[model samples]
Target: MEKNDLISDLLVKDDELAVDYYAFAHPAGFLDKTSVQEVATALRTFIDTKVVGNQPRRNVILVSHSLGGLVCRRAILDYLELGRSAGARIIGLLAMGAPHLGTDIARIASKFLPSHSVPDMQPWDELLQNLNRAWLQRVVNDGDPDLGLEQRGSVKCQVVFGLKDRVVPTASATAGAYLGELKAINKGHIELPKAESLHDVTYDVVKQFIRQCIEGTRTAPVRRAANVLADRARHLVLQDADSALEWTRYEEDVVTLGPLPAPEWLRCEVNSTRTGGLPSADFTICLALDGHFPDGVRIDYRFHFGRGLLTEPEYAAFGERLKNSELAPQDLDRVFGLKHLYLGVGEAPELRIHYEPHDRKYGAGFALLTYRIQPERLLGVGRTNTLHVCLWSIISRNHGWYSYRATRLVLEKLTLQLIAPFPALELGSSIWWCEPERNEDKIDNDRYSSRLEIEGPIPPGILVQWILDTESAGLSR
Candidate 1:
């Protein structure tokens, strides 16, 4: 499966939720783009609405991932500088795979993808070094006597990271975490925010933290300190600083509670399916349903690449790039990968864009196509919401692929259709829901050829392996 998607929806499954959660969306613009301090201002503005006299009426926890952790930390730091405690409302920050010290991925990605965001996350960048230094003193070290967190506004922080994370190193991700607040798992960076199920380690840790934060035990820190050494015990953890979470910038003309979507978004993956004779993206996704809106949904499906979304001029530029680069016609994905899915979607909610290859320990050459559908638009009449989409891409090959891991959501119905070039071999697939069928003789070599279909109730681990024999069928691999 893919780890690029956000898991904020999973938070809704908690029955004993202590605070109302919000998945903050960043502001849209080049000027207000992925800068750390700017996004922090927007974050502070948003927090203002939820608080009275600069302190929240209820307990708050900030859940952040990657660069978003940085944005949240900067917001808190800005408030501490101004003698206004944003942490009074924000009692706890749950940082998942955040880079407190800059990441090396940003250093390398900066070469092909030259964006200000890259430098912000580099380990040796000045801004990053300063942010960490200030944080260690004022936040972690509790340097200011007048700014007492324990007496007036107490804030707690916890960090969770994987030993195997390829994006942000474990050392950088957990630099500010204390022994009491730190958790180390074996999963990768992308898998840090997720759990195997509600009963797994991820959810268990979150539930315990929620209980502790809501309790507001004043003497908890004293107890933690009693069992301590020099660089040792403390009940609190530190927050994140870079990338996906930005300290959004707001120009004087438009300053409000809303954080706009940035000019360019980090790339995401689309299900490999063929649509409208394009190849049916030969892909299928299984998500759970509860009410009018999808209660818990896990979407990892693909549709064969069609054409739309991109502006005509933008499309032409890519076509020209393909010709001039002297790359094979099938290598158009490489050209799109160079651009980093520049959405440029200023203040608009809809995300319609191109494809890019994933980095940071992902499979090489597997170009990712990203899109977003509004919740109102995605939900349907009853519990089951089936929306047909056309994912436009320049690639032609349609290999067999599927994702088994579905978090938070339950899968009740399953309908899978696999279509490929002729002389295909359907190796092995074991799943049953309603019905199953096969046709070995279905063919048309001229247009686009070969096909397979399956319908079933998905079990825990169902594997399907097949071969289309593209070389013998005169189809591109």
Candidate 2:
């Protein structure tokens, strides 16, 4: 039997209540995509009749991987539209590397490959028509926050992402504001079934999500849901340049939203200043979502924070020095070990701090800071003590010199302290520097990226300082 079949069989025959798994078939091609809702309803009916039919009161837990997550998500949507009483019965949803929002691969495949005609699309296909309309409505009305799980309060959802998954990047795995995320290290996408190391990880994540659902704490967070909705509103309104001219504020946070497609200059202004011994600043984060924020879209913001001025001689020399340094395993470990200083996201978002840049252009490259911004649907509460920041060096093949202008610019803007220095000559302080690792696969093989373990708040001073200082540099507030 195939792994999917084997797993399905194992689930169906489980003697215990908790281990029972019900399998459903998903049709292939665009027809499947079109009629997903009806299919979802049918699958739910089957589960209700065959799996749950008067079998005591065990919670229903849905576990899906890859394309399966899409089917399950549609089912959840159906369960919600069917009403709240039904929603309360769903105990948990666990999706592993599932592209619930949508996938580039799907779009690519649909365009290049002929969408096979499913049985439902053969004749007078009212159901197929309805399904096509439903899918289109889902996409067109995505900015309508009332459309998905975010609006449905009863279902508990969690997602697990493989760090090394080839098919779905770790970043693409998150879409819901309430889902809990588990980063499966060094796991591949398709080969996960054969990889023994993944089962426990999968089980552990599902177990936690199910536990939360049973306990009634796994629903998406209200604040996060609201934020997501607000973002949607921002996206919808910003599409019209005329609409964007109006100032808007949601929940007291001043929001200036606009859409800037690729290669278009993104600009914003902030009012920043030092007052009452603290730096107070307001930021206008110009997002170029352009067309990316679809329903179930999770936008993870990767931020770079460290210390440097825009190209000062002092800072340039420091960058060169960092580029020349070599890193050991210990150094590698420290960079990966740094914790988040402070996160602006909520609903128990998962955060991983690394010294080396991630898959982005800055990854493993020297920068002030870089963060893996993951947004989720479930609520997870935790704390960390270490500050995660990405450090990079400005070693260019053409520019044979260094400068501290960037560092100086930052200093002039924010009253930041020099937390640490590279090549610490003293005891126990040498763990921060890492020379560039030479590897074809590493993201920043040519650039110097180091992880710095620092202690401090996210210095409110910096944002305000940058605004105030940069106003002098050129930008207008």
- What lDDT is reached at residue 330 by model 2? 40
Error of 2 at 36 (Å): 2.6
Which regions of candidate 2 fall more than 4 Å away from where they truly are? Answer: 1-19, 28-34, 55-58, 86-88, 116-151, 193-199, 215-477
Stretches off by above 4 angstroms in model 1 are 1-7, 27-33, 50-58, 85-88, 146-154, 178-180, 217-477
The residue-level lDDT of candidate 1 at 291 comes to 6
Per-candidate TM equals 0.41, 0.35
> How many collisions between residues are there in candidate 1?
43
Q: What is the per-residue lDDT of model 2 for residues 205-261, given as tens digits with 9 covering 90 to 100?
A: 544555566556322222223334344333431122322222211111111111124
